[model samples]
Target: MLQRGVRAMRVLRASSVGLTRPAASRSLAPNAARFSSSRSRFPAPLVASPLLQRAGLFAAAAASTSAACAFCSSSNVAMSPVAEAAVAEKAAGQQPTVVLYQYEPCPYCCKVKAVLDYLNIPYEVVEVNPLTKKETQAFTSYRKVPVCRIDDEVVVDSSAIISRLRELVVAPTTASNEDEAALAEEEQWRQWVDQKLIILTPPNIYRSVPEALQAFDYCLTEGKFTPMERRLSKYAGAVVMYLIAKRSKKKYGIEDERQSLYSALDSWVAAVGDDRAFLGGAEPNMADLSVFGVLRAMHGLDTYEDMMRETAIEPWFSRMTAKVGSSSRTASN
Candidate 1:
């Protein structure tokens, strides 16, 4: 079990560096809510068949050799059947759980969930109103939301969670012969969303009544600040965010960034288009999942609703939701 887990991890790492399957052509749903209710109550039991064991061993050996060759390092592959069993055990008999340490109104957390829904991955959500929950404080010392636990693995940040999910859940479709050539292209787009689109966005856009109330509630629970102090802190955070967005816009040229973002969105929409109903050719694929994750944030804000509605993006969003179905939709507070 340990050897197999290590092998899986190695394969995942390689894929992260552009080593695995080709870019698949498919469209996926737009939210994790699609899968939230369908996950098995327990982790699927590991098959103990001898044939499976042999296959696992072969896979581990091949992955280790590939890693060694790629990095020109001596093969130092290690396996731990015990550790693998532990992880499997941890997931066993539990609800299909996905515990998220997230504050209310966090766009990033919402983005992560959107991908999960699109992939129809079931998860248990734990809302961490940081100001009030001591457990939340303990879970993430840094007080970041969207910190997710899949069984024994603690996934910090949206990208990491997305990557982890892709590994554990098998996609419904396969990549075509031209997938390799497209992997880099898709990766480049994903990086742009993370570094430029998300990092450069203003936060005030999400300061709805629910979000403000949640912040106030959190402050009251933490008891570290008075109501006024909490308000001031949130306001200050917004100011800082605005300044950061302003600087980014100025440096990158707001028009240029906007154009780039729009172009990316347009390209993504076209890629999925009306033809097959998903970004990947027939079924949802990694590209569709990743794109949906980021786009969810872009579309969620009320400020962007009109912009989205006025553009080609709206239809694309509609098509994605239709394919994934309404079960994935979350109640907006």
Candidate 2:
């Protein structure tokens, strides 16, 4: 029973928040171009951000909208046939409704949401502060936020969610050869962001015993620390994590790892290039979304602001913020 409980605790810790950072902010330049170039020809549909998708907010909203429409009579029909069909496509599970669970100010959560918005996938957002909500207690079992529910399926982690989304959405193949190559490159970058870039978090954020203890205290006082533990126990656990990061740093050298992380970010931005607006060529693709999730951490932390500003990823950050800011305004209305 003790062992089982321990495993459950680990899972809970993993699911309560997103795994990426604010430093690697996503770009919407490509998406902006796509919309602008096609505005006269083909207007784009509303895109959902990762937070909305993971929290099941979009699905919930769609369900509400459909319910509202059910009250209309045939003689009072309002929606055009095409509009109705599009609604049905979303309602019938033709497109996945992503429900994201997250807390405000979490850089990782922001990163994931940026991707969702870039892709224009319809999603819902559920705001959850693990410290304050009992419902968030359920997350203690899984351990991460940016958890996604597609249809009835539950995906607990960001990388897993990305992989699943790629499988569901078919990439456009009719674009120019250059665009096709860009799409493939973007996909590869997405995988690296999830698998390789994510590993840098422990070293960067939890590098010392005091830092880990402070984090644990914050989590506890903030109400996120679990198991209803005494102060000492929580502090002890924080120390353990601190020790692990410290040891890892000693072996890997924190500065070297930081440099490598920056290099990866540089490579990712260079791949997008100035000519294109987005990583997925003209449309925001999985690559943009994936990278955006990690970059969020950098943006959230004041300490890294200068480093982020100095990098090639800065303009891309502006583009993504603009896109999300606009979407947020629309959603509020």
Candidate 3:
């Protein structure tokens, strides 16, 4: 079991270089809600299988490694929610103990952090050990990282967490058609962030051995592995991710990862347009934040630098960084 686990981690950790199957292309729904309730749950949880199962393990490790490799430093951002979420728990004389179980550099994990930071919700971070996953063992079935434990209830999936937190902090309001239309747009772009933009990251990051090693180095620096584990994972994970990246391009029909990324950014910029400061006009909406969060996760890598150089996303990104303020992390382990 131990040997199998180690082998799986080596093979799977590099899968984080954005190896998840691409979301099928779909047109926007006219009546898309402010946030879709259809959560991004992994197909199966870890404990359900006798074996540490390839698919679930791939998701867990991929999420962990992808998150840890990119934008490890941007965790601390200034809080800038125009309509601040109330500290409701404080009114009851008890604050919610929010603990984020994550893989430091994963874009999904980064998405969650972006929301938390934007809302100025202070929370603790628990870096899940990618191999043993003992940090999340209590969940039994749901073993993926970026799991959020708010007070007693546990929330898995990045979108679900973001939606739940918004619900808890900001009261729902009746909307005008204009408001609804705005929300529909936000929802569409948010979905695109998960399905389209994120799929391009791994292949681009692990385009070659050197790039793969650089990614693993970031992972090693940010993850909670021991000395021996670090040495093994860094070398083995990089090589595996490099191989996986090649297969990912073929599987996704991405002829060129960087070009695809640039095209995606261009599409986003076009949507924002010359008239509006953001997709939401004067303010950054959920969609804007979601896109920013995913892109921010790729920070510090060559892919990130290249994207910034090659795309028109920098201005909007700069605005987001200013609006999304400082780190809301109250603690970590």
Candidate 4:
């Protein structure tokens, strides 16, 4: 059984007091942006900083606007769709509703979020309670996230969800042997990334005790946390995740975790090859999205810098960032 403390820590934003609107419907709230932007600079935990002192006051004011927050929805009121009523809608005329069940700090969730935006598919965010999983229990018997329900068709796992999104949104390019082979090859790499590559992130991000603290700091600050919760969540959560990262490192067969991370970056860059701009040639495919999404979790950490400075992955990572960042369009509420 998963430990209660671990689950509690994962619930960085899981609360009953305030509502959180899905990101697909609106731009990030200002304080929310600051929290996210801090990813680029692993600053001190908000608890230690002056910001935490008044964050509760700010949040109290924000609660009025965020009554329709990401985790919970307002009664009868819905998160407005991203595109026009016609554009984001499917052919059936009845507009499709996509609800994504996720945890705020999870990498797989980050991947699904990227692809949903990249494909311009609007989705409502349901922040699952890591401890109780109250939000996802009705739909899934097991406790896992990045579970996407597209209208009535529900999909689990990040890669599967991405594949489903592509099928629904991306136009079929061709029906040829070459196309078949290309897609097969992409699928192989995508699967490999899920099984082998992504496991590197946990260990690397939480490489050291201090590094682990910084990561939880980012996670806690990015979400809403009371001052008391911030301090307790930081130290206690950091120690737990740091130990967990070590176990993950061993499970992934990473003899030296940092070296394995560097190797993953180098291998991916090599796979993309010098002949093309991306793995999908001019544009990124599911393979590209999968890698980028998993890697997104490492942003702002010291590990991210080592991967960038030491490997050739940064150029491609930046390109993917630039392309994917613009894809998140806010719906008019």
TM-score of 3: 0.74
lDDT of 2: 0.45
Ranking by lDDT: 3, 4, 2, 1
The candidate, 2 or 3, that scores higher on lDDT is: 3
Task: Give TM per candidate.
Answer: 0.56, 0.55, 0.74, 0.66
- Candidate 2 lDDT over 130-228, as tens digits, reads 323333346333333545565655554444454444434333336777766765676577556644565555455455655444444434343333445
- The better-scoring model by TM-score among 3 and 4 is 3
* Error of model 1, residue 218, in angstroms: 12
TM-score sort, best first = 3, 4, 1, 2
Off by more than 4 A, model 4: 1-95, 132-141, 152-155, 223-236, 327-333
* Best of the candidates, lDDT: 3
- For candidate 4, the 10 contiguous residues with the lowest summed lDDT are 33-42
Q: lDDT of each structure?
A: 0.43, 0.45, 0.63, 0.55
Per-residue alpha-carbon lDDT of candidate 4 for residues 1-333, written as tens digits (9 for 90 to 100) = 124323433443343222222244433221121111000111111123221132121122122111111111111111122222333444332324677776555677777777766665567776554334456667555334556676766555554555444434425434578667767777777766766676676688778988877766543543344555556545654555565566566755778877887887888899899898778777777788778877776777787778888888988998888766553423211
The lDDT, on a scale of 0 to 1, for candidate 4 is 0.55
Candidate 1 lDDT over residue span 1-333, tens digit each: 235435444544454422100112222333322222111112222232122233232232222211101110111112224334544543333233456555434456655666656665555555543323344445433233456677665555454555445444433344455764455555555555555555434432423444323323333333244565555435433332333334345545555444555565676676656777665455554545545555554544543564475457777666665655433322221
**Candidate 3, residues 71-143: lDDT per residue as tens digits?**
1111111222311233344333233567888866577788888777766666888877654566777774454
Model 1's C-alpha root-mean-square deviation from the true structure amounts to 15.6
Output the number of the TM-score-best candidate: 3
> What's the residue-level lDDT of 233 in candidate 4?
48
